[model samples]
Target: MNQQTNSEAKEFGSLLLDVGVYLLSSGASCSRIRITMRRLAIAYNYSPHISIAPKSISLALNDEADNALFSGMRTTPAQGVNFKTISGISRLSWNASENDLSVQQVRDELSRLIALPHYPRLVILLFVSVAGSAFCFTFGGTLLEMIITFGATFCGLFMRQEAIKHKFNPYICVYIGALVASLFAGAFVKAGLNINFEHAFATSVLYLIPGVPLINCFTDLIDGNILNGVVRGINALMFALAIALGLLSAMLIYNLK
Candidate 1:
């Protein structure tokens, strides 16, 4: 429990908090965060305890001899999904544990992972719109319906990305995206451009679905992280509500039955 050792424990605790928060906000399940943090702590010869909530993570680091302790908490970043980052961090944890990496080395790897760029915006927009069109086709939409769906989805997702870039409220962004999507599709429906307009309209906004959050909600509940599960479930419900409201607005505007 010397001063230097105590300070090191505190530093390690802070690092653990960083990792937990990053993982949680990036859409890792609560159980996954707990397991990852535990592995990293044990690798560095510290015992770890963590509390993961919907919006924050708390971690404690204790020396093997139980003579020094450090506790820290960090509010999670804005929620998003990045499977690449999650996989990278998971691999980093395994490497750190196997190679007995120093705390600084782990941090460096973490920094590099965080800095990794996502797919270009245009590529995402193109592929996501194509997926929406594919869903329209799968639902028996006509060729014209698929084309309209592609346009709607492209515009809708673009709006969402812009809203996120400007830091709009997440729910508002969903609503806006859905509104744009449904409105675009609904316009064509009203114009009598396609027989299967409903299919296109329905599928255009599929990109806005909170799939990751909804899946993680059940995973957390199954793993006995009830508090986190409930919070995530509620968040997913809000997104659904936003989408519904947005589509409703479009319906009203277009006077669609």
Candidate 2:
């Protein structure tokens, strides 16, 4: 390859890797990331080869006409779920493919999408807490149980968010959230609240469940990505174990039967 062609290949490979990394970190399934990146590559008149792993993604950009190839791998740690980002990037891929966008234009749009802010912290806390209460109610909890569950869920999630902001280990953060929530609900039980305190205690920590990871795990397996699926499955199990250990600690402290 000539100098200019080689440079162009490198640039494209880097950009494609960035896209794959962002998608993976944002909680897109392995298949989704591969499909999206392939779409983008074909749009730019290049062929793409991709391999996704739990903590990394590898991409290669090939130009058949010139027989030029550029390949690279990028680390893509779990960044937490952001469906908005996934959707935005999917749309961007289609737009790029249809409009034949320049590399710079695609880069600008990707930047804009990544820069978008999430919902307000308080807003998330409120809604998620409410959902916890709803779960309690669905399981035949009384009004008081629901109320206590709401408080426990709110406090727990707030602490989790704080811990995340402080860059604590993610599993440790889950444990902290579960501990705080269960403690709050367990306190009411220890106080002889004369209600179904068990219900509140059981449901308060439900918010800590890693629903997305579990779903993604199954999806990856069904899509024939066994390695990624197993990795995700193990990750989900760890989170569940964290929650269980935290709740168990609370039960031991409160001596709850």
Candidate 3:
């Protein structure tokens, strides 16, 4: 019975990891999946591995699914043994890893997701651009401020629709664009542009900071995975800082003009 339990625990751990990895590859933040999977591991009394790559996880899931579907095998999470259980894992697995592929492949997949019938991430992004701009124009502390910020954000986003079509590295592009785009924002500031460089720069950094990882770190903490959680939090904070510093430098330069 002890051996059986141990075996079961391992299987469930792997399944959970694979599923989580699939989700990460599909665009869910790494921190989100890491936190979620760690909890699942503890709940099932399984030892979980750290930082499984999304691509690797997705491929494993695909292989598992193909073997199960074609060979009449089913996965049973509760038992920790994959049998003909006919559970929802298969569908969930498919949904998670369907888009797992190379960088070029991911870009293609992203384009498809953006063009999907139900939800267009691009449209939402466009909205963010306009809303963000409106807020910069008018202080973001009020609804009116948001309107202006969002408007400018929208303009940046809309104006670059063609750029997105080129299938380039959007994260890097947006980060760089924010520097140039923010100059326009700085110009739009009310009170005759006497905004303090440091404060304005700090506040502007919130627009795209990777807050998800910080939240994910706490989630990991809740699951008692202190080391991994802390690491993820630190990494995320580093990225957030980079973004802030980049914005700050850009703002300082613009202020000199």
The lDDT for every candidate, in the order shown, is 0.89, 0.91, 0.46
Worst 10 residues of 3 by lDDT: 77-86
TM-score of 1: 0.97
Report the CA-based lDDT of candidate 1 relative to the real structure: 0.89
Tens-digit lDDT track for model 3 on 57-158?
A: 321211212322111112212211121111233333343345333323333443353333533767766656654544454543444444444544554444
lDDT (0-100) at residue 152 of candidate 2? 98
**Descending-TM-score candidate ranking:** 1, 2, 3
TM-score to native of every candidate shown = 0.97, 0.97, 0.49
Tens digit of lDDT per residue, candidate 2, span 1-257? 67887787788788888899999999989999999999988888788888897888887777867474898999975588999889999999999999888888989999899899999998999999999999999999999999999999999999999999999999999999999999999999899888787689889999999998999999999999999999999999999999999999999999987
Count of backbone clashes, every candidate in sequence: 0, 0, 19
Candidate 1 clashes: the total is 0
